[model samples]
Target: MTAPDPTTAIDPVTAAVIQGALETIAVEMGHKLMRMSHSSIIRESEDFGAALTDPTGSQLCECRMSTPLQSGPIPGYVRHILKVVAGRGDAIRPGDVIMHNDPYGGASHGPDVAFCVPVFHQDALVGFSVTTAHHLDIGALTPGSCGIVDAVDTYAEGLQFKAIKVYEAGRRVDPVWQILEANLRAPQLVVGDMEAQIMAARIGAARFSELIETWGLAAITAAHDDLIAYSERLMREAIRALPDGEYRAVTHLDGYLDDPDPGRRDLPLVVTLRIAADTLEVDLTGTAPQLPDKPINMPFEGTVDCAIWLTVRSILLDSVTFGHIPQNAGLTRQIRIVAPKGCLANPDFPAPVIARFCPGNQLADTVMKALAQVAPDRVSAGIGNLRVASFSGLKDGRHWVHMEILEGSYGGRQGLDGMDAVDTLYANTRNNPIEDIEMHLPLRVTRYELREDAVAPGRWRGGIGTVREFTFLSDGGFSMEGDGHSHRPWGHDGGADGLTASVTLVPADGAPRALVSKIPYLKAKAGDRLVCLGPCGGGYGDPLARDPEAVLHDLREGLLGPEAAFADYGVAAMPAGLDEAATRAERGRRIVSPPS
Candidate 1:
């Protein structure tokens, strides 16, 4: 393919068509990766990302199936990859597959590794294709990646792949592959998943090259710029429609509740949104200081920025409101993020960050809470935070790692009840199948159900969390990283606050023990079991104003007990149904008494 003349004018219809072609290429990449993956985390949970970017690392398109945390950081990954290569006096060559996972550089953490493939047309570099996924084991100190919550420094977390070339000039880097296989616990599985990522990225690169060939270089470039501009215009108009003002919100994370140091527990996260005209600035001026030895600090470029951008995009330019706005670099052009160095959101170099996922999600929720002040109807109330547990053990003298993302609930919003047993905010990953767990590893899913009688009460009641129990069929070791245990999810308006999460470790013979939000690795017997209770979301509106019929329905469904409905919703319930006159009288008496 050759570059066409620069003077030819491209029309809008061609631009829209080109935009669609780019999106199609990304979707294809995601499908290919999932089919080729070895671990259930990527194959079934869909905790991976695929995207295309310009030479300068501006994201052109992304796979909708991937999590925001994985795909949203592609642009950052590219810029850092290019910079690292350049700083080392190296260059990105055709057929070169580069690996980079520097949390301080552009990666969310060490576990979420990225693979990049540069595309060339007629010896001229046009763009690059990239894929990122959370590997089951990145040769961390422990057997799994997600539960390395006790690392005191980056070096202790795991291997840091900084701009290493796994493939150069279309030839395999044998030594790099050998190093990875030697260090990783599950070499066959981890390396296979990684190779899958490379294949998917190469497919994207080929598709992007074909796009340049089909539309001519000149037309493709013009259309790309036009689509970016259109997205920017839509964002500007949305910002203009909002009542411009400063919105501030404060939230906390349950950091190291078992630790002796008081500074590590109950960490505060503050967000101040300065919305003026068409631009938004997220200032993290009062967030908690980074823990010198904790792995929960968030990376500024990858984790923090992704949290802020994804939250604002979902709220302001939601698909329901403006339809499918192009997901590209221009959507983030008008927004600026600022987090002071040494804070939890923008930790300094060498600070541990393996367990940054939950904190980053909380930061996103804080941004949503602040914006709810201006866009009440468009936003949900406080959201239930997620939890991760790494279940690992030995089977026939071989190691097995399984990371489970316990589902969190959604807060109630205008005209709708919160969603139940779902991943919230930036951590959008599906639950691993029970069959997959049993077939591959020596584990059993003893129980799985929704939390009974734990619903948050409101006009639109909050979503309920789930109850999951896992039993070990063999001796094993495991760890955990999570939040929402100490502080309850905050409620909006006059709604009731939500419930916190709890984890219990039950021995086959001994009594059960309560575990904190974050736990280090511990040995388990053959019959050991873990019972996880996901956090519930905060409610919305006044519970007394909730429809009497809704309260009766909840009672009939057993979502809430009769005592809860009578006390919280001020409803008088009968065996048959709601008693209208009795309910009204009860509400009036409750209003008159105003329970203290």
Candidate 2:
């Protein structure tokens, strides 16, 4: 940031206009990348990020379509890129696109690669335009990247590109491109995606330069600087609203349930929020120790920090209250994060973190659970964690890989019911369309719908999870990383706990068998089927406080059985409309003599 001349200070109108323009440029970059990408994960599921950052590596604007996990770590990527470049005694030049995916440095995982382009005006560095996406394969032990649950170390995950220039001074670096293509399993698709990211980042850079040209560089800088301060002020005010105290909560993840070692499964994620006047601190001191051989450990910069900040931002300055505050670095200025070294949230280097997606998300859920003590109205009940599956197989001497993000349910809150069958917390990814899956891959979606009678009862009922059944059209292998199998989403107030997730394997002709939540790459027959049952969300308020009419509505939709209506909510059902007299009597009876 440059010194602001008192005579020509930027007005609020100009600052707001500049902020909106930067956001639009980011959104455009995201659209271009998605349109030009080859893999279903990027094009269909939209698992990518595009953002603009200042020369000092502070985020200015991010694409709204991108997930929090992807965009939130961009500044860290740029900062670490600068560190790596400086350590190697190299300079960033115009037309040079640097590729980075070092988990220990800033990346969320080994699979989410970032392509960063430095923007310059008149041969002076001004900002950076970057795009990051989750690749299908990175030449790991297996064909796919998402479900590499058994990776022993970071070296086993895949290729690691740290500050490598794919394009240097307008010249193509053929060797870097060649090395990438030769290593990946799906070379054509992965390379195509990387090229698309390059073009999109370049487009973002061009748009940023255009803005600087339209409004002088000083004016642009002044506007953003003022904007950042305004955001900080908003956050500080939000912090002041909460009572000063320490709030704590604990949640668990089903880390390697099949492992014989007890330390590998049912791992705990502990969070404590310390609030004082206008500042807050998040400490992950009680989290489980790092799993040396597992890839479930989260990176402190990319995964762990993003998880905490995303939850705090969502809870404090919610859209309804703040009315679309600009997402910049200032919002996090007043928040501090502390995680004990060697814990799951902050692991040592070379601890494999390729499969950190689900556990990182559960960490976000844990933060929400902790903050709920102070901000009850601004939070939800315990959320059902998500699952990811990588489906891969060979056909006619070639390989095809697909990464699917299974949706999870949200717990009910305040006056609203929990969202049903959607990606919860920081893993905000779209579900792959059934047509896209069957048309492009050798798979069949036999069943896709809401689970029957899966409602979590409350005044505002919790969300319902979906049941997905996938059958292999040909012989293939699949692996999954997920949680919420051993634990249920915690209920709020007097609400009941939510349901748990499970997976069932049914062979072509043999008896069906139950499987753990996380699955390693395993062979399957052509006619074998896998049934995924999603966890139901936890309810908010008391189930007895729910309206009888709402219970009748769920009954009509086949979401609740007659026995459940009477037992869970104490609402008797009849053949006609509602047995109001019976419901009143039952509720009164329960109020007088509560059931354990």
lDDT of 1 by residue, 35-113 (tens): 9999999998999999999888888899989999999999999999989999999887888999999998899999999
Q: Can you tell me which runs of candidate 2 are displaced by over 4 Å?
A: 574-576, 593-596
Candidate RMSDs in Å, in order, are: 2.2, 1.7
Question: Candidate 2, after superposition: displacement of residue 489 in Å?
Answer: 0.7
The TM-score measured for candidate 2 stands at 0.98
Tell me the spans in candidate 1 whose CA falls farther than 4 Å from its real position.
1-6, 592-596
Best of the candidates, TM-score? 2
Write candidate 2's Cα lDDT for 1-596 as tens digits.
Answer: 66578765899999999989999999999999999999999998899999999997888899999999899999999999999999999999988999999999999998999999999999899999999999999999987998888888999999999989999998999999899888988888999999999999999999999999998888888888888899999999999999999999999998878889999988999999999999999999989999988999999999999999999999999989779888888899999999999999999988999989889888998999888899998888888889998999988777899999988999999988899999999989999999999999999999998999888888878888989999999999999888889999988887777899998999998999998987889888899998999988899999999989888988988888899999899999854679889999999988866587
Clash pairs, model 2 backbone = none
Please report the candidate that would top lDDT against the real structure.
2
- Minimum summed lDDT over a 10-residue window in model 1 is located at 1-10
